[model samples]
Target: MECAFCTDGIDHCHGTLVVHPDGGFAECTDPGCADLDRIRHGLIIDCHAVDPGCGCVPHGSLGPALRRAS
Candidate 1:
């Protein structure tokens, strides 16, 4: 999937999003670009940052996707 910050190619399997106490959000495990931090609260919900386009299957979708990966 395309990185929201860098617009570079990324695999969802290798990506992670972290939410800070200051209501900031960051994408880690992504090299080069600085982490993205949210300026406002509620911009991110449940820390649900990664999406399918980034090649990451949601935890809810993991079972089927993992089965396929196997």
Candidate 2:
């Protein structure tokens, strides 16, 4: 569920897979590959598939998440 984004110092841009209310996981590739700001705000834009067999979803299907209050 958790991903390390950076190889150096306090890894930046880490991401966690968002599970839907139904228990289905959102599209994701590497956890660390997603944007930090997007992840923080739940606005995941890219698919960081954790499993090699995982497939990507269409950009249109990947809806944006609501931004969280800082």
* Cα displacement (Å) at residue 44, model 1: 10
- TM-score of every model? 0.24, 0.21
Clash pairs (backbone) in predicted model 2: 5-32, 28-48, 28-49, 29-47, 29-48, 29-49, 30-48
Tens-place lDDT digits, model 2, residues 1-69 = 434433334434334444333334453335556543333432343342223322444334544543332
Best by lDDT: 2
Candidate of highest TM-score? 1
lDDT of 2 at 67: 33
The all-Cα superposition gives candidate 2 an RMSD in Å to the true structure of 9.2
lDDT of 1 by residue, 1-20 (tens): 65453454432333333432
Model 1 off-target regions past 4 Å?
1-13, 32-70
